[model samples]
Target: MGPNMLILASAAVLLLCGAANAARILALVPVASRSHHIWNSALTVGLAKKGHQIWALSPDNLEDNIYPNLTQMVIKGTYEKLREDFTMESFVEDSPFTFLKTMWAFGINVCRYESSTQAVKDLLKMPRDFFDLIITEVVFGECMFMFLHHFGGGTRIPVVGITAFGMGPWTDVLTGARTLPSVFAFPILPYVSKMSFTERLQNTLLTGYHWNNMIREYYPEQQKIAEEAYGEPLPPLIDLASNISVILVNNHYVLNGPQAQLPGIIDVGAMQCSPAQRLPKDISSFLNEAKIGAIYFSLGSNLMSELLPKDKLEVIVATFASLGPGIRVLWKFDPKVPIGHLPSNVLLKKWLPQEDVLGHPKTLAFVSHAGLLSTQEAIYHGVPIVAVPFFADQHTNARRLVELGVAVHVDFLTLTKESFKEKILNVTINPRYAENMRKMSNLLRDQPETPLDRAIFWVEFALRQGNDGMKALRSAGFDLAWYQYFLIDVLAAVLIAIVSPLLLIYVTMKTVMNKLRGNSKSKKKKL
Candidate 1:
């Protein structure tokens, strides 16, 4: 009845009404990988379910009916180049940097190919098209920036950066460009937090190589492709990249080792993670039959296990045979691989539901390639692993798992049957690996809301924030020079201050000593 109460009630009503409004979002996920598709689709689908209109450009074949209020536009290209597993194997012979260069070149190929497509060209050319927020998956996806500016109408639009793996060089540079440390940001490399002098030098050089050569040089090419595709003028790629308000990484600091991160780099790590579902009766029966527990082995769907060398494959099969009846090996074997003479304890299947296997109580360990999604699932299930990482970020992922005390690593090149068997036995027999994994799982699962919920909340929050965006969240250091961000000038000032005082004291002391000597000489003459 009172004026004060009535005013407060009106304010509450306004806030409630604002919260209830839905905004249209355009999510561009223009990559071709099953894992990447799954991650992107889940986020967009979740947003649509929250009553927001979503127009998604993706590589997956999920229909609009599968998701409410989602407009699916698929980008068709010969993405099959990714599966030339034999070529990837040859990359192992090259140095890390060279291998990465080859991969980046391939990514640019994908970008150019995708840009030429009719769907992307048409989507950008749509008349007076606009959206409240632009969500894009970024890695080698710099071209997506044009969507923000072309449709932004000469104003800022909030953009969300999503990556299937953790932050790459560009995202690191984009989010915390100025403050990202050169010595310890081993985003996709294998290194502990504490660096030796030599390691620090390598890390710094590696960081510079990725930042300067790979990111800066390679990013603009995508923009050029976008400009040609749009057949219209567009803003500078650098300015557009800087405008990104938030980066939703598919990683958690708990799983990935501790590293400095900007506030805008939100970790919605396992947003696509699902609870273990029921396995088929046969698979369940096989797992339960294992007296000493079963291990799930899969290198993920992108690469086939059959590509493995015959000698190396023989060694692995022999190792499995050595495990005997006590422990069982459920290998996700490609039937085409022709793995001969499997032991009585080993069961090979062309396809197996991985999450269900890991979640089962009888499953003791996972032999994995250390992909981001698979690692999240293992941690979520509280199962330790023997990581046999081959290429890409897998090596770093494995190293991180080792750092977390939940995994033992085996180098694929030098791996003998003896070494593989030892690692598997070591992880399973040791209580420490499983214990550390459970401790991490508690931290991972103990969050306020699920990863999916957090992702949805932040996305909608960005939509509501509008043009003002989270300008404060982005570091002002981006505007500053590298030396200024590093405080080199400040350090210089401090050094001068310290040296100036000491120099003054030394000069004064020397003057006083000379004067005392002169006084002593005069007194001697008088005597």
Candidate 2:
């Protein structure tokens, strides 16, 4: 064979061999929630399609019929289960107090489940197995961090942290971005979407309080488990994240309020499901008929449709009535709204093709409960929003959209027909809102590759890179303390010590000299 042909053949063989040797496997550990599960599932499917093996460990059970290749490990119970056990109704019933209590309970429940579960024990017992990489959810639980610290044995494997929501401070810590917040507080208002300044400060204090409790109470037991599993002294709590290679958040740069700086943190948003599903036939027909435009309304997964009172329902109906016959409203109502002389433009559905409906050309405005996924979907499709936030992070999400100038927030409590109509008309009539949405949409779309593609590529990169990837990750963790990052408190202390005492000494000397001079002057005058 010719020299060039032989070289080409050799290179092809080596490439094929490398492909054969590469066994990129991911562990999908997600907290139990439909929203979280959906994102993790999407990542799993995407990676698997790219010829990687995925072991999904979650509290929610995936139907075997759907995901045959994906190995499933059910955590069996969740914080929701514990909440039920603890009769947490009072906490949820009391608004802000309930929110704070629920977050506290959630943290406690996570610790409890980690201690109780056999899944961790069994997974740890596996014989130093050959898994190229690990990716697990950070928010739902910290078990993934515990597992990696225990099993990793300082043998470098790339660990990727995935967050179902935005890259909050906690996720930022994993990617070696900024240090994790010292305060580990719970949400103050469970029903309300946003926290007041006072509430935010209180939450910060609570966070510190919880962390102290965990360090004093919970760490000893956790350390014991780590020592037994890894046969070495566990690293400090802050140092546990040294093994993480990359952190992927299900948030777009356009959507996030404050951008976090982490070396390997990537925003791979709405990566859970492929946007392939077609709009339902009836919904399509309705939209087609509306030559002008249509509005889509959905409250998201968890909240029951029946929870909304009849008076509130009337306000919505009356608002839609005022919009007249031109605009269509596709309301995702539960048990169906009673058709008592309603507008011909309204279409009520128990469930709608949310993504497909948003993707439609005729979708002018989205009236949402401000769930993170719904918020992203609206932005992804470039539809302006009239956000009527109900609970959880919806208020924060709505406020963010409003800040971006793509949505307007209306209080659910004070939502009158006139107010709703006014907000809707303002959003629809204002070209600026739609224009800003389009700008964000373009930014979200302008990446070199699709979010799913980037996510898969990074997973493979983590696997191929291995211990070197881990070493890089460890180096990033050097700045994992608030004092180290900000240096504010240190600077304040130094300034206070140096400046205060010097000023005091100067004042005292000046007073003494003036008194002495005065005494001398009096004696001289008497003589």
Candidate 3:
């Protein structure tokens, strides 16, 4: 009851509040793919290690359940199982057309799953008073954005958007940057590689238009729910750049090209906190004895190694053969290798400790599909890569790494023993690639705090800021229209309207004056 007592009690309360604010973080990751799950799981584990509470909402999985200080809400069923019924050959008879069909189908399937999942629906419909900071995977179909807009309810807990791949247009827009070309929207035609300046511009515009339309088609109910939840007008597109405070791309600046002008987007690059798991004892001993180092081959989780055509498989095998005895091959093949003459140094496993093998000093080069996680892992370990991109954003990731001077790209369809051999040799044998990779490795590792620490710090910061952060996020999505955003179209239309009427009136007056002059001349002649 005394004044001094009251003041002391109030100070204690304020100090406790500050402590709680600094320790809380909620990460919502609804990733369905195995590779995506692994990447997200690593982040969750890292954040947990930093003493932050993690609220993970993902489909049911082994890793999600096991993470410490983490609560997981799993959506049932595996995406791979669903794809077994939907075969690639059924969708695209030709090889060239297959990648596009696969990507589109994959996106659609993910969207459908998210939209229909009971857990997602229930979570969105619940009263929005849980979790401080929401970190959602950007490519969780369309629902990630929907949840951010709906459950987020325009309160600023600092929605941090995590991208498994590089910063695409949607991510860029969310992070307060100007729009860029959509790699997903562009046509999958081979000639796309040879497109001219005008053609590329046309493709870019068309891609944006298609994506804008696609978002509407995928989540019509999101806008209505968001408006109701937030009690304000929502942006037309569900995934607006401004809704996010931080855009954390799982790419290193060294491998990815120049940074886009978005201040909010940060390249954390693979965020490999744990070292590679140790290789099996037998494999390890083999690696140690191999003088020339080992070639690590993996098609990633999404692409089954058994699915490749016989010829394509042979090309890979033969390339390993040409590398000679000094180089050992560790291939992650799904099924046991078909009965054939196997190379003496080649080692095939149903599963191998990929990161561990890559981290090993003996890992000469990585033969990969250029998936974002794999690329990041290779880069993090300073190992050069020979990227044979299969589908999705793999091509773009490959291009980015090659541009970074640390990786060589070998076209999948046109691949041969010679090309594969040449690529592997160029990346592994050349000191330049290793040196460039080392430089990037240094940049990736140069952060003042570990990526885990920074990520944890931001998450807690967002939570502490709360509603103020949310309002800032919503305001970031503010845009008038195409006419307003660009203004050039409006200017051109106004100029055309004004000029057309003036030119028409002048022409009419001249015609009438000419006719009157002719009449007067005839009268004079008659006189």
Candidate 4:
């Protein structure tokens, strides 16, 4: 063939190859939280960059999502519904049980709202195999798993689960991963894995709460909502949840310490973390000009710093002022909130570019609420922290950081200017915290491939393997009943075997002794 003809032929083959590899994915992030959206966006956008077509359904906007291959289908007003009902006060004051109940309720409502959306309805109208794979946030949004059945038709569309935090007890059940209370802490509880008896009791009870309350009570409720939304009865949500192909959890063993995970459970923590970018001109100048160093303060998205009680806010303001002229404080404060006077060392912006600020060499320490994303970012940047955890897994994250020697914990409920200042200074002024953080940062960065890349590869692998190949990775333990899984029947049989043989031998010996005694009595009577 001529050169021109040959080039055209090669280009045609390449196009065919590209067309064959491209996958259609539906990414569901029904949890109405910005942080969760960050984790989901990383996966979806990363996949899109790799030539996959992605339709991301989320309640919140995907951060910096501008890919042509990726589209965002908004779940309208889901977050507003959350904001209308919950506040920072409620989060801090809620006990574990109350928090679990409240979260389950929110999850049910989210399922109803998401399933009713035009985007979901349109997707449902498509053929069962329309999408090659479904990636979803399974933390507080297991109800979204109903789409697995709706789209599965006869054969299932593979699903990959993602969570914005470490794998907890619920993750264990869903993925058939093992989590001993002795080796792994319950994510919501403020105890470490190596706990005292009392702490283990609490952790075990919390674990049971997942089975009894979440699986039994919460899943049933979500199942009903899913059926109502679909306008038909569907397969059980728990079964669908267990059918996940792979789980990309947003935690690393370096942070949470190591634990047993099934083959399908993958650690893709810090997927959202990236190299530092240039900050705004004004912010860059402020940090670069700091005489000593700077500190970044944020309570994450869910817990707003502006929502802090007046007294606590006052304490924070005063503490920041007393940090001395050399050290600058970039407090992520809402501009709308009025403050009559301000300290010269303190700067307030409604939103600061969090990762960029933490990545700055001038950034010395962080004052954080210990949200997983923030904690991961701090770990990535080698910045020590003053963890002022308020609720949920914040307490556990804070405790882990302290155990790792990279942070000092301060109780938010009992926060005072003195205590806050002390905690901040303990991490900032001391060289030990910085050294430990540097070591952690190195460990987290020393990976073979980026976490996002690993996540994307597994997703595409699932697409290629389809449902059956993914099913092989699922833990067989999930198919067993509780009694079977624990081997209660086997244990009972072994116990009976040993006890019955011993009892028989004892009865035989006792009968022979009685016969001997009777013969002796008869001889004595004859004499």
Candidate 5:
């Protein structure tokens, strides 16, 4: 073969060899939330497409055979009952602490189902040396780590921690990455990097308090559940947590702040993020009907729009009606409810191909619950947004979007029809929001490789590089307390060391001056 042909032949051989060595991946995602499932699917499905064998354990029966190598085993009737009891009333409050409480409680509920569920019991019964790689979410489900011990016959298997949310302090713990909290916008706490001294102080204190709560309450809670499920002395939750080979976060600086990260932290913020295939004919015709551009609205996969109280739905319907005939609206509504009268410009659907709609040229803006994925889609499409935020990181994402000058935000609990109309007008009519979003879109889409490609490469890197005990993985901060890790106590000792000599000299000088004064007084008396 000639030079060029020889190079191509070598490349083809490498690809063949790589596929032949494909590893069996065990992805444990035990959540019922569709939004979370969507994010995790990006990683697991992407891996299956690369010809690796994947076994995904989830609570939902999501059927797809596009990647024949991927098998999803659904644990039916485990956590859905718990989710059924969940309502907007549980998520209506707009505080991060309240969101944290809901998340923790939900996590505890998941643990209860998993520990007693037969599917998980069966999974635990599998042979110890079953899979080469294990992937899971890093949130409250620590008991799942018992698989790490049970699988591989007490040998270590690489674990990857992924979340739909961005990398935060909790994920940072698994890796050795540390970012200056003051230099990064912490969306969860409502503080950006550029803040006043007092704001920074409050931010620092709140973050510390948040970490303390996680360690004190959340960590202990997960540890106990794992012990009960494993029915033995489970490894310390932190130790298992430290072995995470990689952390996949669906975050980009365009939507959230650009925080510092370590090599082990892969920033595939838009993994599995792409415009959808051609919209179904009905969905297309609705967008085509708009003389002016249309607004795409979704509460995302987690929050069902139909769950809103009828009064609130009426307010939303009225707000859409007020928009002129020129402006069209695509609302992701529940088919179960009767939306009394729909305007000619408004179309309701139980489902939407969200990314495709956002990518359409006629899409003027997006009305969203400020889901991270939705926000990411809007950014990728260069479309501005009007956010009706309800709970969780959605509030933070909305606030950041507003700060980015790419969105108009309204609190869901206090939303008024008038206020909603005003925001829609502001974002759709004003040129600034669109301009800012487009600028962010350019940056977000300008990645060297597609987010999926980047995600796959990193995962494969972990599988190969981490095969031997994940030696390249950094665990420096695993055993260190905050004071020791930050060297706060060391700094204090250094300050004392420098100040001590100065303090001693001052004391000596004061004593000499006092003695001299006494001597002068005695001389004056004798004369």
Candidate 6:
């Protein structure tokens, strides 16, 4: 054959081989947040590129899928509901407990809505063995796994769980991973991995509350929804959830602090992050023109910066206005939320390519809400941060950034023009923040295999192994009760074994002493 024909023939053979092994996979991430969609879609699309048929169900379409093998279905109204239900005001005004309750309510509501969607209904009509594998978000969407059980037709198809952000203790139970509350603080709290005694106590209590609530209140509601949707009784969701073969969590020891993870639990954090792309002309020009440096501020996709309270917004604007004339500001704001004029040096866009902005040579500091994805992106690009954490894990993420010496955190509730400006200046001008961030970025990038490749390999591994084969990776702790897993029973037995002999010796000695005393008294009386 001619050289050209030979090359084409070889390429065709490779494509055919890939197609032969292609599996039908479903990606269900019902969370309405854009960040969640981004992480989940990254995996599904990557799988599609490998020639697998991927069907993704999410709240955001994440633009049209570029891969022809990937099909995306949007869960209608979920995003709209999120925007209406959670606003900037809610983020700012809600206390920690209030925020937890709000999340609980929101999670259950979304789960119900997701199960009722027409798209899901159609999916339900497919053949029992239509899919080879199922990948769904584990947090708050456990009910979605009912599809796995349904499609398995008495035997569940191999399933993988994905957590777009930090893995919660509740989700860790899926792989029987130990959650040391003392070492791993609860996500909502502002404590780092190394915590004080009081912090650990609080973390333990809050972690218990989350686990308890999920089992008692959350699971029952999710179970009801699943049963209602299936129109038949199903196994308990906790049981179904435990059947998850593997979970790809968007967390790494470098960013989230080191901890023990079960073999079944894989860390694929920053998989959604990539090398910066070339910035758009306008954004590139804006950053390049900065005589000193530029600050990129975003509240991420969930919170809208335009909804900042008038007084607070004024304080922020004044702080930005006070920056050196040479310094520039690129702020992401919603065009729909009209706002008063900003400083001349400040430029606002409805959307900005965040990774590119962070990657820009002139970019000095990132002013962010500290969402996990944004934090990961900043780490990927080696950018320092001024974190203004409003709610959720933002507090914890901001605290970790400070603990790592790569960011300064600002309390939104106590934000003042002076404090905000000082934080911005501290992060931008200080050499430590940038230096520390560079070190962290190196650590995150130094892994042997790219996170995306590692994730895809494990996914394909699970498919090849099947559910039965995947069980070898599951922790034996999965079958253990909480007390048993902690070895409370073992400890109790050991304690009893040691204490029983000691008690017996003490009692025998006492009895002998009493008898000796009695004998002495009787002899004295007889004499």
- What is the per-residue lDDT of model 4 for residues 274-335, given as tens digits with 9 covering 90 to 100? 98999999899888889999999998877788777888888888998999989999989897
Looking at model 1, report the run of 10 residues with the lowest lDDT sum. Answer: 83-92
Top-TM-score structure, candidate number: 6
- Please state every model's RMSD to the true fold in angstroms: 8.2, 7.4, 7.8, 5.1, 5.3, 3.9
Question: Model 2, range 1-527, lDDT digits (tens) per residue?
Answer: 99767755654454455455445454746465666676777787666544455576677666532333456777776746764655432232345444544554564456556545666666767655556677877654653556666446236466777887665545644554542333222423221224566766765665555445444644454455445544557666445655666778787757654354555777788675345366878888999898678888877765544456778777888889889878899888764646455678888787776888988888889998777888888887889999977655676677778877999989887889998999998888889999999988787777788888888877777777776754665433455555655677789899999999999999999999999999999999999
Off by over 4 Å in 2: 1-28, 61-68, 75-101, 110-130, 153-156, 172-176, 179-239, 257-260, 272-276, 321-325, 336-350, 475-480, 489-501, 504-508, 511-515, 518-526
lDDT of 1 by residue, 1-527 (tens): 89767755654454344446767788888866767777777898777666677888876667434444678877865366445322555554566677668767766777777787778877877654567778887676677667777767225457777888676666756765542444454555666566677767776777777767754668778778879877877777767767777888887778766657788888889887778999999889888999999888888866557777888889988998898898998889866666788798888888887888999999999999888888888999899999988777787778878987999998888989999999999999999999999998888898889888988888877776765767767877777766787899999999999999999999999999999999999999999
| lDDT, model 4, position 282 | 89
Estimate, for each residue in 161-233, the C-alpha lDDT of model 6 and write its tens digit.
8888667876666777768898987888888888999999888888888778877887898899999998999
Q: Per TM-score, what order, best first? A: 6, 4, 5, 1, 3, 2
Better of 2 and 5 by TM-score: 5
Best-performing candidate as measured by lDDT = 6
Q: Estimate each model's TM-score.
A: 0.85, 0.77, 0.78, 0.91, 0.91, 0.93
Cα TM-score of candidate 4:
0.91
Worst 10 residues of 4 by lDDT: 9-18
Off by over 4 Å in 6: 1-17, 92-96, 153-156, 510-527
Estimate every model's Cα lDDT from 0 to 1.
0.77, 0.67, 0.65, 0.82, 0.77, 0.84
Clash total of candidate 4: 0
Model 5 RMSD in angstroms: 5.3
User: What value of lDDT does candidate 6 attain over all alpha carbons?
Assistant: 0.84
